[model samples]
Target: MIKVGIVGGTGYTGVELLRLLANHPSVEVQVITSRSEEGIAVADMFPNLRGHFDLCFTVPDVDRLAECDVVFFATPHGVAMSMAPDLIRRGVRVIDLGADFRIKDVSLWSQWYKLEHTCPDLVEMAVYGLPEVNRQQITDAQLIACPGCYPTATQLGFLPLLEQGLIDHRRLIADCKSGVSGAGRGASVGALLCETSESMKAYAVAGHRHLPEIRQGLSEAAGRPVGLTFVPHLTPMIRGIHSTLYATLKDPKDGLQSLFEERYKDEPFVDVMPEGSHPETRSVKGANTCRISVFRPQNDDTVVVLSVIDNLVKGAAGQAVQNMNIMFGLDEASGLGIVGLMP
Candidate 1:
């Protein structure tokens, strides 16, 4: 079994990783680190893993982690870049579920993340870890950059159009709504139960960090510079992301449904619902599934697409595990072939 280590394992994504990897047959959870919760029993912090993981949180020791077959950084944006370089040099495969290695341009990443990147050299080497688009690169990469929640949902919703040159890349807009858990397990006033329980509002509308990340992915698919107008909203729910994307169709011939179906024909995680079907976020909850449906407005030439994913699963931990499976030549669905739980 491949030994795995997770840095910053007390956070939502980290615990989510622990939940999934604990049962992963081909891999073993060797270590889970948490600076704040060091020396505390992980099960005490999250009772959900009581019997499964009896381990305690520890400090991040690079040497000890390097001994593992693979290491995952589920920390904040700047934390991974500082640690990934050292881990990669020790011949350890690293997958970062943070923004550190996701953006190819260090300058742009720094501008949005508000922190200077300590390792620019690794930026070019880190492969974007969207399995459907960058599968081969991920298989050969030592460092994989798992996508952001917003970007993952948005990119998957629109990639088929961009790949087929069916949309006007210059005029792309993404309006994504995510549950409160997407903000992480922090004690922010904005994320309090009373505050977000029954309200729905948009935050970071003008300059959300995911904007550039989405553009980068779309630009790569389009093979040209693409601009995006993105707005992110916080829904009152607990664990899903729904992205409604709009783009002008260059040619209305293939349209939305046919284009999406053709593009994701071989993808295991993505399920393109039938034409005119609407996918509910709860339908994809607790699983690494991205359900998509497309609609072409009768009068307008704009294509409307809806994409839903479990923010913590396909959006974070599950995707990180998916990258790990790809890097190790295991089936991408090795430990992730779980069906969604629907209410």
Candidate 2:
């Protein structure tokens, strides 16, 4: 069995990892650290994991983490970079669920995160863990940099159009809405029930951190630098992301639906819905699936694509587990065979 260690088990993503791994036949949770919640039973903190894990939160120790086959850093940005280097040298694979090694340029990452990157050299080798695009790289990578939630939904929505060079890459717009859980488990005045419910507003219009990451991925697919306008919003719900993407069709492709279907035909988690069908966020709640649909309203040049995913599932922990499955050569769908939670 693949031994796994999770750093920072108190947060949403950390516990989410344990929740999924609990049923994974090929993996075992060996260590889970939380300096703040040390000595507390993990199940006691997150009752949802009551019967799954008998482990407790402990302080992060490199020796203990290095003993595992792979270490998942579900902590804040800086925490992973500081500790990943040591664990990596000990032959332990490192997968960062934070933005520590996502952006290739150290300076750009520093600018967005407001902290100097402690281990910039590792950035070059950290394979971006987007299974749809970088599955091959992720299979043999020593370090994995999982994509952000907004980026995952937005990129999946725009990838087909950009890949075929059928759209105006220079005039792309992604208006995304995410639930409060994307803000993390921290105590934030903006994330309170009274503060966020019955309210919706777009933030980071000028520039969001995920902007660069999205641009980089699209630019790579388009084979040129892409000009994009990405705007993200905070929705009232607590578990999903809905991305409405717009782009001008430069080539006026004949089979847009077929194109999207063909591209993701072999991908396990990407579901390209039938023509004219709208994918809903709740349809993928608690499931590691990105449901998408394409539209060409008015038979005009402007094409619209809608994408939805559970912000905490396909957008975060679920995707992280998917990457782990690939890294260990197990069934890609193992432990991820989850159904959507509907009301």
Candidate 3:
């Protein structure tokens, strides 16, 4: 069994990791750290994990974390870059569920995050942990930087077309909407009940942090620079992300549906819904599933694809554990076999 440790166990992503890991047959949660909630039982912070994990959270210690076979950094952006280096030096594997090591360019990471990277050399060794595009790299990687929630949904929506050169890369527009939980479990005034309830608005229209990550992924897939007009919105719901992607098709006669189906035929998590099918956020809620549907939108030159996923699941924690399973040579969907929560 692979022994695992999680740093920053008080947040949404941390608990979600425990939720999925609780049922993992070949993995054990050996250590969990929460600087603020140290000594508090993890079950107290999350009643859902009452019987699964009876362990209390601890403060992060690199030496202790290095003892585990794998450590998951569920902390803020800068924490992992500092901690992962020591862990990696000790031959311990790491998966960061933050933005620290996602971008290859340390300057871009610093510019977007507004902090100088503490471990820029390790950035070259960290794999971008999107299993669909970088599965082999993830399996062999010592360090993994999981993609951000918005980028996860947006990239998956655009990856197939961009990789196959089916779309006009220069005119890509991704308009994404995510629930409140995407903001995290912090006590921000903007996320309060009154402020978020019965209201919806777009906050980062100019430039969000996920912009660079999305651009990087698409650029890699297209083998060239791909322009993007990425706009993210905050919805009133608690979970899920729905992205509408618009790109002009290079060939008006090429069947978009057939192209998407053929591209994703081998993928387990990405589900291409039948032609003309509009997928709902609830349809993929609480599962590591990305449901996508394609349309021509009255013009053969333009293709619109709708992608939906539980932002907290496929977009974050579930994907993290998925990366862990792949790294450990286990089935990618082992403990993540949650079906959508349908009413």
Candidate 4:
């Protein structure tokens, strides 16, 4: 069994990790840390985990974490970088679900995240944990930086077009909307029910942190720097991301559907829906899946792709588990064999 430790077990992503890892046949969740909630039973804090986990929350301890085969940092950005170096030296694989090591360029990461990177050297060694793009790298990585929720949906929507050199990379646009739960399990005036409910608005229009991460991935795929306008909105729901991507087609082709279908045919998590289909975020709720659809309206030069995923599942915890599966040579779908929760 792969011994797993999760740091910061109180947040949405952290608890989500617990919910999924609890069922993984090959995984044993040994350590779950939460500095503020030390000694509190994990199930007491989150009733959803009452039966699955009988562990109590402990303070973040490097020694205990390093003893595990893999440590998943579901904490904020800076939290992982500070502890990762020690854990990595102890031969423990580190997977960060935050933005600590996702961007290769430390300066760019610092610019957006507004904090200096503690382990810039490790940033170079950290692999972006998007199985569809970096499956091979993730398998051998000592440090895996899981992609953000928005980047996951947006990148998957645009990857096939960019990789095939079929779209104009300069004018790419990702108009994405996410549920309130994406804001994290924090007490905030903006995230309050009275504030977010019955309302939809965009934030980070100037430049969201995920912009650089998305551009970095697409640029690497396109073999050239790509320009993207990424705007994120907060919806009234609880757990999902819907990204409507737009790009100009270099040529009006007939096989766009084939291109997407063929690109994700072998990928276990990415579902390329039928042509003219619009993927809904609820379709992927509680499941680690990205449902995608490709379209070229009126046979114009513009191609639109719709991608949906549960922000906490495929976006954070589920994808983190997927990376752990690859790192440990287990089946990629080992712990994530769950269907979306639909009504």
Per-residue lDDT over 1-343 for candidate 2, one digit per residue giving the tens place of the 0 to 100 score: 9999999888888888898999998998999999999999988999888998999899999999999999999988899999999999999999899999999989999999999999888999999999999999999999999999999999999998888889988999999999999999999999999999999999999999999998988898899999999999999999899999999998665699999999999999999999999999999999999999999998888999999998888888899999999998989999999999987
Model 1: residue 121 alpha-carbon error in angstroms: 0.6
User: Per-prediction RMSD in angstroms?
Assistant: 1.1, 0.8, 0.9, 0.7
Give the CA lDDT, 0 to 100, for residue 275 in model 3. Answer: 88
lDDT digits (tens) for residues 28-126 of candidate 1? 788999988899998899999998887889999999999998999999888988888889999999999999988888889889999998999899999
Candidate 3: deviation at residue 294, Å?
Answer: 0.8
Model 1 misplaced regions, further than 4 Å: none
Position 240, candidate 1: lDDT: 99
lDDT, candidates in the order shown: 0.91, 0.93, 0.90, 0.94
Which scores better on TM-score, 1 or 4? 4
lDDT of 2 at 265: 98
Least accurate stretch of 10 residues (summed lDDT) in model 1? 250-259
Highest lDDT: give the candidate number: 4
**Candidate 2 — which pairs collide?**
none
Q: How many residue pairs clash in each candidate?
A: 0, 0, 0, 0
Q: For each candidate, give its TM-score against the true structure.
A: 0.98, 0.99, 0.98, 0.99
Q: What residue pairs are clashing in model 4? A: none
Tens digits of lDDT, candidate 4, 1-343? 8899999999999999999998899988999999899999999999888889989999999999988999999998899999999999999999999999999999999999999988899999999999999999999999999999999999999999999999998999999999999989889999999999899999999999899999999999999999999999999999999999999999897999999999999999999998788889888999999999999999999999999999999999999999999999999999899999877
Total clashes for model 2: 0
